[model samples]
Target: MTKTITAVGFNFDEKQSEMIEKKLQRVSYAEEHIIDLIVRVKHEKEYSFDIVANFRWGVQANVKAEDFDFGAALNKVMDVLDQKIKKEKEKVQQH
Candidate 1:
């Protein structure tokens, strides 16, 4: 699985990009089932981070969050995605 991150209204330095990759990698359940991670960041009034986690077997999770800080927004969105990923993992285990 791979993560694709695109940012608008800001340029992501290598360090910042690596930080995002690291954060996404921290999700264990998402690592196993997720096939593609599409991250779109928009910097309007506030920093908006949108994440699309595309998992295997046609399952997917989408989360959007906004904050003055990019890291905060990213963390928020990732938290929601983690919950969704965990639920999907449990669903598979039950079957």
Candidate 2:
């Protein structure tokens, strides 16, 4: 069961939201376990992206990154999230 993601940002529109979704799909994760995805975006000197992935199985991962470019920030956060998800998945499996 894939949870709906809430992407909130400062000065954002539909296109930006779609961009975020597409970026998410670019990564490989077992998203069906995700209970919620809260994405916070901001521009404080540079583009900042944060993702909070809450799993229904009680695994939550939070990642934040900043870069000069929006795509870079997004990529960095996703990479962190991916690593976190992998670790959580392995932990769950070991249980």
Predicted structure with the largest lDDT when compared to the true one? 1
* Clashes per candidate, residues 3 or more apart or on different chains: 0, 0
Which ranges of candidate 1 are over 4 A from the true structure? none
Model 1, span 4-95: residue lDDT tens: 88989889889778878888876854576889888998987888988888878787788888899878888898888788888988998898
* Candidate models: Cα lDDT each: 0.83, 0.76
Kindly give the stretch of ten consecutive residues in candidate 2 with the minimal lDDT sum. 1-10
- Tell me the deviation in Å of residue 81 in model 2: 0.7
TM-scores for all candidates: the values are 0.87, 0.80
Q: lDDT, candidate 2, residue 53?
A: 84
- Superposed on all Cα atoms, the candidates' RMSDs to the truth, in angstroms, are 1.5, 2.4
**Candidate 2 structure quality by residue, lDDT tens digits, 1-95:** 34344444457677767778888885435766677777778776888887788887977788999998877888889889888888888888898
Model 2 gets an lDDT of 0.76
What TM-score would you give candidate 1 relative to the actual structure? Answer: 0.87
